[model samples]
Target: MAKADMEQFIKSQLLKADLIEIDRQLSVTGINDMTSMLLLKQAFITVSNLVDFEITIRSIYREHEKLSSEYKSSSKNYEFAKYLRNKYIGHIKQELIQKSIEWKPELRYSLKRIDEPGMMFIFNLFILETAINTYVNDDGSHKIFESETDLKYPPDLKRFLIYLSSTVRSAISYLSNLANAFGERVEMLDASEQKIEHWIAAGETRFEFIKK
Candidate 1:
């Protein structure tokens, strides 16, 4: 699929969910708006914030200077800065979980869980899920885990595990919701769509105005 077609698919999916309103000319304006909406929904990343370690490391290493400058409030580089901030913050959280366990041995204590990337990914997944559930209709009680198990809060291993598990689960759940809406299996296919490149090449990326 092309970018336009992919956006069209997204819009159609959202429409199927009765989640958004598109104009009559869905071929043009609707797809554009829908693309923007999905970008906003995913917060401009192809996946959630806790990306795979290899990609994350490469991204940070290659873009560190640009990212660091973005972090500096004085610069007008708002987008890159925000990206760095969010990603680094997520990194910090992961580190904290890891350190918490290390603390156990030195202090002759034990923590609830290990701070692995899968767990970190799950944590981010939870945050996204929380935001989505809140947006879907303001139902906040829809938690990733229904039970108040051992790790129900921070500083506790069981709670952290729940948090991580919930994160991964939520991504899956919301994506499933999206798939049902678009009438197509949208997972991982967004990148394969060629229309996005076509639009960029033609400099017709604006949603409100596309030169037909």
Candidate 2:
């Protein structure tokens, strides 16, 4: 293969690797609300992974400084993925920590739990009761709960997880299609490349094969 063909093949392989990563992340399953804390943490991780996938896809277009019409059409999905990442998973928590420190000036921010109102109340009640018992016993290292099933997940959380799973699947499909289209364009360019002899015969060898 010619040097130019080798370059195009490498570019296509790199883009395919990106697509495979996106697919692998999206293929992550078994994220459900078995426990409140576990569910919240998993949800955060899922959104973060989706955001990374979007960034990978964006990098391909940004490298060339041009966006395909298909990618342009799915701009809303990309924006929403970014919003979920920056607002909920990434920046908002940092902002909350900063605000807490500014307001108290001596207290540290700690995320103990995230759950619906009813579920939070139940967990708080359990903790309060357990603390009382442990205080009477004077055991500082006692376990909080014997089993994971001790904490029940809220209905609202279950519904939200379902919605989030659907959203992630939709985003993956949209982004995968865009990546595949990009691969197709790359393949077309590689197929359209002329041999050095042919280019010389046509007096077009002066043109460079610009790899983007």
Candidate 3:
């Protein structure tokens, strides 16, 4: 594909879902922000990989063009040969897109506020949110500060922090494996059964052709 064509195609995918107008003060704001950031980060990596793919494709075409010119002869069928080359190029491009999509992640994030609070719950949130910080009573609510507290994070924040940390690690690993699979990436919105059926059909056909 042309550079402009590839860029436009990639841009359309990114623009499909965007984080807009977030309610920052809401209780669920933190989880939303984290999810948005993760999605954006994944998109960024995919775009970078797309660029690498474009460069590789261009190089292949340049080499193909050189060889095509060298083999052209009055007796040799140049038009037929060119058609074969173009078909091969299209197949390669499809494979590249499929691989890139497979590697992407299916991420889900959730947050629930506990109305029935306890001393332990409060401590855990405090610890995770403000690591190594000591809480102080201020206006009947607990507060932790950087300069005053011996620890920055309190125990209350611990569970949240651990959850976020493990989530990030798992997401990265899942994405890496998915990308390495070298197949079309499915979206959360896509019908799972239909997609699987298509893949099975394609795989069978490909296997049959290879055997022949």
The per-model lDDT (C-alpha) reads 0.34, 0.43, 0.32
The superposed Cα distance between candidate 1 and the true structure at residue 2, in angstroms, equals: 8.9
Tens digit of per-residue lDDT, candidate 2, span 13-59? 44444444433443464332234334433444544454454454564
Among all windows of 10 consecutive residues in model 3, the one with the lowest summed lDDT is 103-112
Model 1 C-alpha lDDT per residue in residues 1-212, reported as the tens digit of each score? 23443454454344333212212122233212334333233332322322321122233324334433322322222232234235433333454434334432322231234264344434433333323222222554423334322222344444433333333333333334434433332345366665666678688644576574
Candidate 3: Cα lDDT at 89:
23
Residues 47-120, candidate 3: write the lDDT tens digits.
33333343333433343454223222211222221222332222223543333233321111111333343432
| C-alpha lDDT (0 to 100) for residue 172 of candidate 1 | 35
Q: What is the clash count of model 1?
A: 11
> TM-score of the candidate numbered 2?
0.35
lDDT (Cα) of model 2: 0.43
Candidate 2: how many backbone clashes?
0
Per-prediction CA RMSD (Å): 18.4, 15.3, 22.1
What is the TM-score ranking, best to worst?
A: 2, 1, 3
Which residue pairs clash within candidate 2?
A: none
The candidate that wins on lDDT is 2
